[model samples]
Target: MNLIRPDKIIVGMIHVDALPGTPNHQLSVCEIARKAALEAKLYHDEGVDAIMIENMHDTPYLNKNADHEITAAMTVIAHEVKNAIRLPVGIQILAGANKQALAVANAVDLDFIRAEGFVFSHIADEGMMNSCAGELLRYRKNIGADKVKILTDIKKKHSSHALTADVSLLETAKAAEFFLSDGVIITGNSTGEAVEPSDLAGLKSEIKLPVIIGSGISNENIYTYWNQADVFVVGSHFKLDGHWTKGVDPGRVQKFMRTVHSLRQ
Candidate 1:
């Protein structure tokens, strides 16, 4: 069965609280799981199509290869959130922890994962990120988690793409397709920034893969990219005051879903 339907999907983000071992860590694993599940429940009640749990608050993230504790903490939180909501759920570990995210997803029976640096190289705030399509997919298969979809970010946010400046966005997307990415994500320069509509249009016209709008989708502008995107990964817009670091506001979610529902018709 295709987990990501052909119809437009609105994936709400559950920014998992600071996990143990991270500098901002304070909450116990159980407490973090409780908070995440609460947000998941809210998203479900508010009519989101799916949920994506992320360790966004785990500041000063490792460039790659998250520690065992981080992985363990995420596993607990993902499991709890998955149980709290019936919608398709996914997870993303910070700073390119694709393999760890996959392991957690596989263990928790998650529907998918949002991966960074699935193809090509880029310099992120965390550090250099290299293509991991081959190893990541292989690891998925090896772990018997082929059922979990890997949605990758191309020209990821909060990073400089100067290293691949010679390569056009379309070329990078084609490369991802060539490497067998389940889907390719398009994002702006930083978090909560709106993706250029023309960029989504370009990929939709040329690529056969599902094109996901990864950032800056708000209730107001959903109409602009509605026709072009297959999936909208909304985070900040649904949070209180449109801030990623704040708690999710039920009112914001309802308002955004209202716009999305209208677009679906």
Candidate 2:
């Protein structure tokens, strides 16, 4: 079966609450899981094509590796979310924790993962991140999780790409495709920022893999990327008041899905 639809795929993000290891840890793991499951149900009910649970609230993220506690906590939350929704579920551990995210997806029987630092070396807020497509794919093979698709980000957000300024975005995307990424995501400079329409157009024109719009999608500007992008991963806009840290607003989700449905027609 296809992992996602042939038309525009709408993925809603569940910014999971601060896990135990992070500085912002306030709620118990059970509480956090409950909240995540509720958000997943909200997205499923509101007509999202898929749901991605992320450890976005884990500030001061560890570079490239998540602690065992973070992984265990995420597993619990991911299980709860999987039970709550029938739509395709995915996970992303912040700061390039692709392996842990894959482990969680494998355990929870998730469909996909949003991986960062998959192809090129760049300076992220967490520090310098190098390409991991080789090691990550090998790990996936070892763990027997090849069924879980890896949708990678090229020149991802919250990073400095000056070291690779000589490389164009298309070249970066080609590298990812060459490295065996299932799909490629294009994002803006940071969270909640709009992606350049020209960049989206350029990449779509050249790349044959699935092209995902990873940030800054909303009811107002969905038209700009309607035809060029295969998937739209929305987070901040679905929350209360368009803030990433707030709870999922049902009204906002309904409104946005309505717009997407109209576009699909």
TM-score of each: 0.97, 0.98
Which lDDT tens digits does candidate 1 get at residues 1-265? Answer: 2534656899999998888888999989999999999999999998888999999999999997799999999999999999998999999999899999999999999999999999999999988889899999999999999999999999989999999999988999999999989898999888899998777766777988888999999998999998788899999999999999999999999998888777777
What lDDT is reached at residue 193 by model 2? 96
The lDDT for every candidate, in the order shown, is 0.91, 0.92
**Candidate 2: where is the Cα deviation over 4 Å?**
1-4
Error of 2 at 182 (Å): 0.6
Of candidate 1, the 10-residue stretch with the lowest lDDT total is 1-10
Model 2 compared with the native: what TM-score?
0.98
